[model samples]
Target chain A: MVQAYILIQTEVGKASTVADIIGKIPGVMQAEDVTGPYDVIVRAQADTVDALGRLVVAKVQQVEGITRTLTCPVVHL
Target chain B: MVQAYILIQTEVGKASTVADIIGKIPGVMQAEDVTGPYDVIVRAQADTVDALGRLVVAKVQQVEGITRTLTCPVVHL
Candidate 1:
């Protein structure tokens, strides 16, 4: 399985909403509002790298109120 | 408890080693090497925000291979 951490920046005052919505997405393992450069941080997993990419672009990004996202895929090495 | 995700950048070819070292630090729940802007992504917790800050600065950052760190503290809302 391919797992990743998705650092997200959301519109002002929308962090919690974004997290709540994202936490319910199929591949999302965890999503929480956070304080710092990114407003929310998400943990997700998929069967392959391509599927992981699609999850970010097709689902997570589609969520309203998100301004930006940085996907960091976990590496075994 | 104060929980946070710590995004880290490491020196060239140091990603795995950095992840190994960080995974052993107290309060660090998970640490893994990753591909993208950051080399390592860590999940950690502490008694308070100040303690979490200190853990990152005094412990996580002190590791030789780490170049930078961004701490995002989880919030209720």
Candidate 2:
């Protein structure tokens, strides 16, 4: 299983709505509105890194109000 | 309480050691070795944003082997 944390920056005043929509996307475990450099934090999982990338780019990024996304994949060492 | 996720980048081959050391820090809730852009992912908490900043700059960043850190504070909407 591949898990990642997606840091998102949204348009001003759009954080809450963006997060709400992201939370319902398949593979997204949780999406929460947040304050700071990032406006939303997301936890998502997929079967592989490639699939994870697709989820972020094809699904998460397609959401309105999102400006940027930085996906940090969880790794075990 | 101010909670944040700290995405960390470390020198090559230092991810495990960095995570180990960071896990012992007082304010750090958890630290794990991870691959991709970040070498380690940390969860930490403080009483205020300023205190959180101090925890990152003074404590988390002080550890050797860390190259970069991006703090993403959690916000409730």
Q: What's the lDDT for all of these models?
A: 0.94, 0.90
What tens digits encode model 2's per-residue C-alpha lDDT throughout A1-77? 89988889999989999999999999999897766688998989999999999999999999999999988888777
Worst-scoring 10-residue span by lDDT in model 2 chain B: B32-41
lDDT of 1 by residue, B1-77 (tens): 99999999999999998899999999999999889999999999999999999999999999998889999888996
Mind giving the per-residue lDDT tens digits that candidate 1 earns over A14-49? 998999999999999999988889999999999999
The two-chain DockQ for each candidate, comma-separated, is: 0.92, 0.58
Tell me, by DockQ, which candidate is best.
Answer: 1
Error of 1 at B35 (Å): 0.9
TM-scores for every candidate against the unseen true structure: 0.96, 0.82
> Distance (Å) between predicted and true CA of A19, model 1?
0.3
